[model samples]
Target chain A: MAHFEKASSITEWLDQRLAITTVKKVMALEYWIPKNINFLWAMGMVLAFTFALLTISGIFLLMYYQPNVDTAFDSVNYTIMSEVGFGWLWRHIHGVAASVVFLIIYIHMFTGIYYGSYKKGREMIWLSGMLLFVVFSAEAFSGYMLPWGQMSYWAGMVITNLFEGFSPDIAGGIMNAPGLVEWIRGDYVPGQAFLSRFFMLHVLLLPLVIIGLIGLHFAALRIPHVNNQDGEEFDYHEAAKLYKEGKTKESKVIPFQPVFLSKDVFVLGVYLIFFFYLVFYHFNFAMDPVNFDPADGLKTPAHIYPEWYFLWSYEILRPFPKDPGLIAFGFAQVAFFLLPFLDKSDTVAPANRRGLFKYWFWIMIVDMIVLTVMGKLPPQGIWNHIGLVAAVVFIALFVSLPWVTKNENRA
Target chain B: MKNELKILGVVVIFTAILYWGVEPFAHTQMHKHVDGEHFAYSDLNESTKKGNVENGKTLVMGAGACTGCHGIQAVAHKAPMDAATAVSAYGVNPPDLSTAGGLYSEKFLANLIENPAHALKVEHKFDAAKGKMHPMPAFYGAGGDKAQEIADMVAFLKSIAPKEISPKNAYLDACGRCHANRYGKLDQLGETPTFKSETDTLKHKVAVLEYQDKLKAYMGKLPPDLSIIIRARSEHFLETFVENPQSQLEGTSMPRVGLSAEGFEKVKAYLTQTGDPSKTAREAIGPWVLLFTLVFTVLAYLWKKSMWKDH
Candidate 1:
């Protein structure tokens, strides 16, 4: 009962576990972070926090989830509805945490790009980060299928069918292979095979890969440190001086330990509240009832909408004219994987940036927005023309921006 | 160095706790169980009852065994009059017992089932005028005691028969083996036959106003042609044909009718005899074929074991 009676024992325990060693202490809180970093810098921590939250919530959710087609949807419902000794609190936390995870990552990515965080020594970090992004998308999608609802089933159909559009050269002989289709489909249609495979990918294989890759990402981040908004390296001495001088004491940039931990708790609480509201009060939040039915090739759902993340992409292909739009759609989807290559920023900070590539960068953004809108809208005559123009402009800017940025940097 | 040790210590503790205490709780292996939604007709309210149609199912499938040429209960297929097809297929022009008795009375059917010769007198007259009766067997053997059983079966048929027989069922029932295209073959027949349409494919289909005429013509019998196949003759005569056809009729040029229990009942209900019994010497070849198959399987297994003996 008197565990902390002696302060020395507690201090010794803390020192053995959490305290920084002398050598590592030299590269402590004042060593890497920039002094003038803004709220945008908080995005990375938010992203990290989101990942941790998701992992915890995910573990709890996995307790009750069944991953087969016949049971997947019901398992999810049970978790949300009947597994209520815990007030369905864990499920809500997980559901909300997933959306927040995406929200934080999106913010983090845009912050990195806008501030040119992908430059120089940070390239490995950016690459690892991009890989993490891909893994996250895959994890989300596989998780979507585990629910085995109507949206989940049709979404799997829609997304998997996307691979069909790939040229045989790129798609390989897998699709054309005999019995491969049966393997993918499991039965003659989407049933136990698809759900169970997706379940394994979502819960087991993908998560393992994600954990390893995330470790690499963090290691890479440690190599060069977090890139700041101003292109120069952090003036740590000044930051330490300010911290000692009471200036940072009152500043918004708080220490990550206690203060940010509390903030994360608060944000997590907000997310939990919303999650429960949806799970219990509106459990069918992201679901479509029609998706509950088995997939029949004879009947198609009236409208197929991709998950929210792919909405922009889906919108891009919709209004595309038959001939050029097909190619445009291909290029647009391909561009998602090609994003890290498309934006060429040689500097880590915006303050020291110099380039004639800004125009091309703006053009890329405009084109993407246009393409996204085009994909969302139903096909019409003028929209088709706009889509054509958007596609051409997107291709132009996509190719030109990196070249222009690199050239100007060289100059 | 101290900071590094501290960090390493923390990481070790985290991983140790995770791997030991947390992992098992995190990984709760659960399997999916579908909430089955089976519906029972017996459980339904009076207004909503699908009725004891299953009785007809038993008669057609169990005693009748109409599935030989027709498809199984779950799988829909057109059936010929052979045994296996009779149990499975819903029947082309064969009249699905699931809904057949609505058009004809049980007594009327029982009378017909008693004697195919008496019942098919009209069609036989037609055939007689054309030439000789089509070697059709006289089936009415129920005598006096089994008439009510036949009537109950016909009642079951009236509840479930399809309103219309499609060209697919009719073609499959009457001429599937010999013909590929129902429309194509019918066009060549030079008759512009009334049964070639999309609707008149099944024998006891509800939509048919002239189901009796079509069924009589298809069965090669006449109105009130009961011939009591279920009562007079060995039930196995119908049962074997309904369950397995190739055994009952050797080189039997009958179309493969995939008759479901409902279809068999409808046909049975449609066929109960009305006149005196004319006992014809009909042989049941099913037992011989069954015995042959069993011996053959046993011999095949023995041969297989002998082949593997050297190995």
Candidate 2:
């Protein structure tokens, strides 16, 4: 032990002209991480780690994949079914990690929202996190077409076609322009063009924007005090002074030495086991075999669904009748991003709500679940219309939340 | 620590089972095939020649394997090609039989099938331009009633041809798609063959080039590339070959291509050749490829840097 310290001496410091250990501390330390964070709080870490794995796997995929119609499907199959050592595992991991990343991010956001983590002190961080969610979603959307499979082809067709639903005149012009339509198609339809452009966007562009936002999110959050379980902001100086005074007495600081660190490691290990299970055995996670066929623009996939996590949001948007002016759909759809604003009440606890707000919150949750189920099932008539009515009514309730809260506080 | 270790062990075993042990059960969703409904084999007959196209869908579905070579559009089936892998595999033009009746009368198709050589008009502009077209392979080797069956299929195609369009005009329209002024370039309108319109260009190119060897020899001293030869050959030379192949040169091995007088004239006038400009320039080669590579590399590097920078 004496020799171990002696070997790490002045000569090593002199060679660099500064302590080498300082660089390690700067790089490796998570100084901004909340000390009180529990297993639920670890979702962000898991997602971040998964993002890294996805990036690494994505690099390998770019090596052999071809995007053109003739070779696009064949090349992906070659990668998965034939070429490379255990290429199927790589494909499965990349695919599952996509779903997993969204899942974790959603849970993290939900936790943050419920805890009022976006309260004035951390609004910028919350806003950045929300923006990152959208960026990652677009990344997933672009990446979906990279497989050039039946689902990828048709889903891309349906979604890109929605840009037309925004402005028919513009959509018609864009759809008619040989070059523009071809560009949207990745050329002529689900073949090389779609696959190649989507691959570049997925692997490079989306990740860059997401990472930058995530950095800002953390930096902004660091400047404010982290919210505690009791919802009281920590006055760090007062807390530190009290802790030092109590050090001679029976003090309480969760030590990094054994107890909490070991617990975190154990939880992480369990989480990873779940992660690896999905990666290896449940390799078929959400990706359909039929999607292995190249995209034919004329032939839409019989059933179109978004990634599973977005099924709730996609469900909410589905119910509005197409004939209604854009306001109906636009208002219903925009509610998701506007959720942070909608749920703004001084009270974070659900149990304390005196009147309709609590019931409405439960109704919204149920509506979301119903929409999620609807997102998976094929469209039906009267029932689907009823679902849409419910969505509209719930949206109204959500929109009126701030006013309702003000009235209740005055009473 | 012991409880933590036990929890960790359970997690590992659970994960291992979930990852490696789950049985992959096969499930077939009610996926609708793009091709239509099936027909029974018992429905096969001479009368089946007038069969419903909807019922003929089974001929191309799973186990039918018809989709392999024939494209989704059967009448205009062209092999799909990737730009990078198989540029020549899908030729610039393929035959269009959308309006065959206008280009060749029913009797002409019959005689042509029976004897390709006698039916073809031999063109021998010079001895070098005298390569006979390979005899079209018989639909049934050594001949039988398969000829009639093939004729029936041709009739089926003819039935589907749009009522308003002529074969020559349809062929012209197809040709004028990429080469807008193909027929307009023919100086000697009466002497040279040309498409009446752009649509029939593919049909004319295919029919004219069907005599590939003869066409090659005809342009021997001029441009070597077929793409370019169409541009170089004068209206008169092209016209003579279409009008009377054997009469133009003695010892000419060229077979007559039984084109109607109007069809022959239209195709000859329309066939202008041009070479792909990219191949001839040596200096542009390095820089063009390098430019794309640089852009791609720079984009890729920026992407990577941005993605990992935050992490």
- DockQ of each candidate relative to the true complex: 0.01, 0.02
Candidate 1 local lDDT, B1-311, one digit each (tens):
36435533643453344233212221121111222211111211222123255454554455334443233322243444542233123222333333224333333343344433333233423254567443433333234334443444444555454566443343333332222221132211112345676666553244232433433344443222122223323334554454333344444334223344444444443332111111110113334434554555455445534432322
Candidate 2 TM-score, true structure as reference: 0.52
Each candidate's B-chain TM-score, in sequence, is 0.26, 0.35
List fnat, each candidate. Answer: 0.00, 0.00
Q: After superposition, how far is residue A118 of candidate 1 from its true place, in Å?
A: 0.8
Report the poorest 10 consecutive residues by lDDT, candidate 2 chain A: A248-257
Evaluate model 1: give its lDDT: 0.49
**Regions of model 1 farther than 4 Å from truth:** A1-31, A86-93, A165-188, A235-285, A288-298, A314-345, A351-357, A361-363, A378-391, B1-311
How good is the docking of model 1, by CAPRI class? Answer: incorrect
lDDT score for residue B68 of model 1? 36
Indicate which candidate wins on lDDT: 2
Q: What would the C-alpha RMSD of candidate 2 be, to one decimal place?
A: 19.5
